[model samples]
Target: MKITTLIENLKNDSQDLINESGLSLYIELDNKRILFDTGKTGSFITNAQKLGIHLEHVDAVVLSHGHHDHGGGLLPFFKVNSKAKVYMKRKAAGDYYFHILGFNKNIGIDKKVFEEYSNRIAYIDRFTEIMNEIYIITDIEEQDLTPRGNKYLFAKEGNKRVQDKFEHELMMVIKQQDGICVFTGCSHKGTPNMIRAARTIFPSLDIKAVIGGFHLMTIPMLKSFSASQEEIQAIAQMIVDENIQKVYTGHCTGVKAYKNLKHILGSKIEYIRTGSQIYV
Candidate 1:
């Protein structure tokens, strides 16, 4: 399997591609072309074209969560990949709000978009295989290492807003040659928790790699959403204990958090950026 980053927060040396606080990946595995999480805007489209990725031929598009940064490009993606089917958690359509300094901002995929693509989008409520060896995993019970500092996020239930339980969050597990590769969006449920869930489902396969956003990024200015140093350290240790061979994380995995992880995981942890490519 080969994967190429279509969009990310960093551009590395690719001056032509636009960068934003979003993520997108184009993956090719065994006669299947899959797109995992379209980024915030059309930038991913442009970047994909430049990277020689044909979005029009994508076999499937899997959304990891309901956040706009992860699913915002759905509109443009549909314009190109008419034959591709979209998959997401059944609860991903809930109204989501991101608490800012003093107010809450609705940061979810547009409802109108979902309505327009209702027939094309498949709402997943459980573990289901969309392709030969790729599965969409849902309802991850956070038995341990739950995500921290996410109290600010809220979801609308009835007429009231409550702390987001992240019921809409989902993950993808792909069967690789020697092991399994797990791809996540922001991991709002906690990276360790997600890993544990994947391990349970595929107990026989070694976790070759855990890739995508870790949600460990903390901007000093946005203190409410950032993970604590101790939490980051603990997450790193958990990954090591789990014996995950490679971790390609970036985007929401804050610079400091990633640096610390790199220190601990050494070459096992790699910073994924725009235009980056990986073969498994």
Candidate 2:
């Protein structure tokens, strides 16, 4: 498997690619091309072109959640790829929002945008295999103590700001020669929860690595209003306990959170930025 960071929050100082508060990964596995998430703008497309990646040939596009930062590039992608099938949870079409400082903003995928390509979407509600060794995992069952930093995330239900259940959140797992590598979006449900869900699907494989945002990062506006120190430590320890060999995280996984994780996981944890590539 070969993975390229098409877009991320950081860029290699030597590379001229643009960076944003989003995530997009272009993955090649078993001679198949998969566009994981589309980041937040056309910057991903620009970077992919510079990297010589052709979007028209991607076999599939997997969306981990409904957050705009992850799916906002769909508009530009649709203009390029005419054949790639988009895989996402059915609930992603619902109203989702980010509530902060007494303000609620629509943070979900644009329903109107999805309607334009509805014929090409494969909205799923349960765990389903997209192809050989590739699967879209849902219904995550949390086996570890993952801090719920989702008090601000909500889904509208009859004029009520119901806390987001994260039903639209899904993960992708690839079975490799060594073990399984998990790809997540924001991990609003938590990385441990996603791992536990993956284990249930492929119980025999070791969780080799996890790549994406863990969402355990601190808020820039409300520095004192994030996951507790104890919670962060527990998550770091959970990765060690699970024997997850490596963790490549960025975007929402704040600098402070990465520092905490590095203190425990050391070199085992890698910061993924734009222009990063992982092979397994």
**Among these predicted structures, which one has the highest lDDT?**
1
Put down candidate 1 lDDT per residue, 1-280, tens digits, no spaces: 8988888888788457777889998999888999999988878999888877889999999999998888999998888888998999877888998774788788889886689989889999999998888998996888666656566678899999889999999999998779999999988899888998999899888999999988875432252245776777777877888899999998888677788788888999998889889887
lDDT score, candidate 2, position 266: 95
Task: Mark the 10 consecutive residues where model 2 has the least summed lDDT.
Answer: 217-226
Per-residue lDDT of model 2, residues 142-206, tens digit only:
66655456777889888888989888989999988889999989888877778778877888889
| TM-score, structure 1 vs. true | 0.95
Candidate 2 ranges with C-alpha deviation above 4 Å = 218-225
Please give the lDDT score at residue 278 for candidate 2: 87
Q: Which residue pairs collide, candidate 1?
A: 217-254
